[model samples]
Each structure stands twice: as structure tokens, then as C-alpha cells.
Target: MKLKMSIVDAFADKLFKGNQAAVIVLERWLDEKLMQDIAAENNLSETAFLVKEKNDIFNIRWFSPLCEIDFCGHATLASAFILFKENEALTSIKFYAKAVGNFEVYKKDDGLIQMNFPKREPVKVQEFPNELLEGLSIKPKEIYKNVQAYFAVYEKEEDVLNIEYKSELLKKLAPYDVVVTSASKNREYDFVSRYFWPASGGKEDPVTGSIHAGLTPFWANKLNKNILVALQASKRTGVLFCELKEDRVLISGKAVQYLEGNISV
Candidate 1:
């Protein structure tokens, strides 16, 4: 079968800046193994497969090169980008995921896509795992853990940038990734962060929107503010506008189309 595939750079105004997610719009659900193979073939951080459920609703799933994940923010934005571009009349779209539940994406007047995601507020963990500390070259001032990943709080943005990960050790922290972050030195941004998921996705993620769901609330409480700007300090960087609500986090960014073609499977 021939399937339509598009690569979109999410959280970036231009191509090759943000995380690239491969999005495929499917009319029906394909076999799980086939979808996994497709995602592995794409070899991106995340590949999104979606099937339209209604006029404005879609059921979506995300997969990394290694396995299917419960949630992925960039791929969802990329999918919304494709849907918006295809139908100008569409101002918003609702996406349902099996484990993550429902999320809504709206097109702003400024051309940014705003995603309403559940707040994943992390709590301080009293005991720091030895493997987690051993996996990183730098020691964190504080550490927090949630369902998804570990949050490593650093003293400065420079520390976050200078981190060298021991991928082998990180692999020991399977099923959970690590996020190292600190207050941004740059005046334009409120905080800076880098994500590492050697055990799950890759050694490093260019720009991650899903983690920001937890990061936003964590920083907001620490900084004593509700709205903030975050910059992911990966080689291919990206910026995100985050707002912390009572039970949800609003992540907003722009996505640009990188490639579009047909995939034969």
C-alpha cells in the first residue's frame, strides 16, 4: 500500500531547527507490527499515525525507533500542522491517544499551534538513584520524578549545556528518560533544558514538547509565575511558550513542513 507521509519540524519556524516528526494519515488502523516497522524505517525520534474519527477528531499513536510510546508532543503538533495546511477552514483539532487521553490543538492568529496537554507535575524524590547520578557527568542540585522521566535541576544553564551523558548508565534507567534543566542565562528565555532518553528514544532529543508539560509547572512554581518561555539547548534547538493552568499546561509553538511524499509499504 502507498501511504502519504510528511515530515514536519515542530516547535520551529523554519526547517531543521526543531524536532522532526514523521506524520502519516491513515484511513484505517494498520497492524501494530507494521506501524512499528514503519516508525523504525522513518528512524526519527517519533512517528505519528492518525486515523480520522470524526470531522474534527482523530485517533493518533506515536512510536519511536525502538517502541511505541504513550505520548509525544512534537508529532502531535506535526499532525496538526498537516491537518491545518490541508484544510484552511480547520481552526482546531482534537486528538485522542490510548493512554494519554484527549488533547486539543488550536491554530492561533499568529500562526502558532497551541496544545492543551495534561499537567505532569513532578514531585521531589528523597532518594536519588545511584545509576541516575552515575549516568551523568554533572551532579544535580535537586531531583524529581514522575511517571514519564526524571527531572534533574541544575544551578545554571551552562551546567545544563556542559552535561555529558553516560549512555550505558542511562540505559539502566529504562522506561524513564532524564531532563536536565536550569534557569536560562539568556534574558529572552525563562529556562533552558535538555532531554536524554538513551534507553527509550535516543541519547538526546532536539526539542521535546511532552516533557515541558511537567517542566512548565515545575518552573512556574519555582519562578512564581504562570507564563514562561523555555528553550531546549540541543544542537537543533527549539523554543516553547508555556502556560501553567490549574490542571493543564498549554504549550504553543510553530511547525514548518519539511518534506512530503508517498511511502510504499
Candidate 2:
């Protein structure tokens, strides 16, 4: 079958500067194994698949090269962008996704898309595994565990920028994904972070909006702030405007379309 696909760079003001996601539109659900194969073939951070459910509603799923992820923010943005471009006449769209315990995507009036995601509260863990730190040059100040992944706190912002480690060791130690975050003393940003997910797929994800659901609240409580600016310090960095609401976290960013084409398989 031939499928229409596009690559979107989410959280980017320009092309080639953010997380790249492959989006595909399907008439019906493909076999789970085929989806995995397609994701592996794409070899991108995340490949999003969607099918029309109604006039405005669509079903979405995200997969990495290695495994199916519960949620992926950048890919969702990519999917929305594709829909907007393809169906230019349609101003609004809704997506019912299996990610993040069943979530919805809304296309906004101002070209900005919003996703209502689940709140993943993190619990403080006593310590991190020795192997997890052995490969890295520095140590995290604290460690916390969430349902999706774990957060590793660092002491300095410079440390976050200059992080260099062995991906193989991190993959071995971490069960899922590991987030390296630090309080930014810099006046520019409230926090700086890097996400490493050797197990689930990408070695270093450029910008992770879903992880912020846990991170925004954790830092808000620690620093006693309601709204803050966050930076993801991967090779392709991003600036996220985040707010900690009573029950849910709101993550906002800009996305750009990188490529649009068709794929045959």
C-alpha cells in the first residue's frame, strides 16, 4: 500500500532544529508488527500513525524504532501539522490517541495545537543505580521515579550542557527513559533538561513535552513557582513555555514542517 507521510520538526522555530517525527495517514489499522516494522524502517525518533474516526476526530498512535511508546508529543504535533497542510480548508481537528492513557489533540485557531495529556506524578526515589552513574562523568543531585520514566537532577546548568556519556551503559541501567534536569541559575530559563531513552528508542530526544508533565510540577513545588520557562538541551534544543495547573500541566511550543511526501511499502 502507498501511504502519505511527512516529517515534522516539532518545537522548532526553523527546520532541522527540533525533534523530527514521521507521520503517516492510514485508512485502517495495520498489523502491530507491520507498524513496528515501519517505525524501524523510518528510523526516526517517533513515527505517528493516524486514521480518521469522524469528520474532525482521528485515532493516533506513536512508535519508536524499537518499541511502541505510550505517548509522544512531537509526533502528535507532526501529525496535526500534516493534517492542517493537507486539509487546509479544515480549520480545526481532533485526535483520539492511545498514547498517555488515551489523550486528545486539538488544532487551535492561531495555528498552535494543544494536547491534553495525563498528569504523571513522580515519586522521590532513595537512590539511583550505581551503574546508571558509573558511565557519566558527574552525578545527579536527586532521583525520582514516574510511571513512564525517571528524572535525574543535576546541580549545575553547565553540567547539563556539557554532558557526555556512554549510551550503551545508560541503556543497560535505565529501564525506560532517563531525564537529566537541573535548576538553571541563569535568568533566561527556569530549568534545563536532556532526555535519554536508549531503551524505548532514541538515544537523546531533542525536545520532550510529555516528560514536562512530571517535570513542571516537580520543579514548581521545589521552587514554588506557577509558570516557568524550560529548555531542553539536546543537540537540537527547544524552549518550552510551561504552566503548572492544579491537576494538569500545560506545555506550549512551536512546530515546523520539514518534509511532505509519499511512501510505498
lDDT of each: 0.93, 0.81
Query: What is the per-residue lDDT of model 2 for residues 131-189, given as tens digits with 9 covering 90 to 100?
Result: 56775667878889897777888888888888776778878865557888999987988
Every model's TM-score: 0.98, 0.91
Query: In candidate 2, which residue pairs get closer than 3 Å at backbone N, Cα or C atoms, i.e. clash?
Result: none
| RMSD to native, candidate 1 | 0.8
- In candidate 2, position 2 carries an lDDT of 84
Best by lDDT: 1
Model 2 ranges with Cα > 4 A deviation: 54-56, 88-92, 107-111
Q: Write the per-residue lDDT of candidate 1 for residues 1-265, one digit (tens) a residue.
A: 8999999999999878999999999999999999999999999999999999866579999999999988899999999999999999999999999877888999999988999999999999999999899999999999998888999999888999999999899888888899999999788999999999988888899999999999999999999999999999999999999999899999999999999999999
TM match of model 1 to true structure: 0.98
Displacement of the residue 182 alpha carbon in candidate 2, Å: 1.0
In model 2, the Cα lDDT at residue 191 comes to 96
